[model samples]
Target: MELKKILCAVDLMDTVNPAVEYAKMLADMSGASVSVIYVISSRSTYENLQVPVEEIAKGMRRIWSRSREDMDAFVAAYFPGVDATGFIYEGKPAEKIVEIAREQDVDMIVMGTHAREGLDRLFFGSVANEVVKSSKCPVMTIRPEKKSE
Candidate 1:
């Protein structure tokens, strides 16, 4: 397929590098421009509020600022010399990813998964799983490599 644009979903965690690498590889092969998206789930940011609304808002701002820094660092580290645009979104990760992919008209999506299965998958629903199910374009999920001791 002739890929013009590629969307990469990253959580800024252990899976970030592997997912970015996979996306970069695909983009290189297909001559596609890569855009990286990092979603900060509202559930984690706005839940269990024990403080005032202003305090909550302040906390969210701080989180967003930090997330932006992390996203920039991630791109600089893993995608140096590549023109990768980074985006930060607020909401459920899976939904935000799919929305961005569709809005950007990306040819494909590359993301990383923890590879949770069985009861784990049932309890903590996988974002990658959800994206694959809901995405209009093709979704490619990569598993992070295990570190050797």
Candidate 2:
């Protein structure tokens, strides 16, 4: 398919190189722009508390800050010709990814998923599953290689 823009949604747990490489290759092949989205979905433990929100927000900022820096450096050095933009969003990951894909008019979306089965999948919802079901455009799910192997 002819892709003008591609949306890549990644989290802290996602492997940086493979996903980025796949995105770059797609962008190059399709002459599309790649936009990387990272969402900070940290939730407050206490529903009603006087705890400082900035405490969590600050940590999120730092996490994203370092992540983005690494992402930028990688993109610039490796994907020289691809136009790359990174975004930070807050809220539920699956919903935010769908929102961004629609908002940005991305033609295709690529994401990575850690094996979520049984209680893990039940307790924590699957972002890739949700996005594939709800997205207007096509979704690509990448399974990372096992670190133990």
Clashes of each: 0, 0
Using TM-score as the measure, the top candidate is: 1
Off by over 4 Å in 1: 43-45, 49-51, 147-149
User: Which candidate number would show the highest lDDT if scored against the true structure?
Assistant: 1
Which portions of model 2 miss their true places by more than 4 Å? 16-18, 42-54, 147-149
Worst 10 residues of 1 by lDDT: 11-20
Whole-model lDDT, model 2: 0.77
Candidate 2: the clashing residue pairs are: none
Write the residue-wise lDDT of candidate 1 on 1-149 in tens digits. 78889998887755434588888888777778889998987845565755677877788899899989999988888777666888999898998999999999999999888766689779988898899999999999888775211
Q: What's the C-alpha lDDT at position 44 in model 2?
A: 54
In angstroms, how far off is 78's CA in candidate 1?
0.9
TM-score of each: 0.88, 0.79
Q: What would the per-residue lDDT of candidate 2 be over residues 85-140, giving only the tens digit for each residue?
A: 87777777888899999999999998877666788789977878998999999998
TM-score, model 2 to reference = 0.79
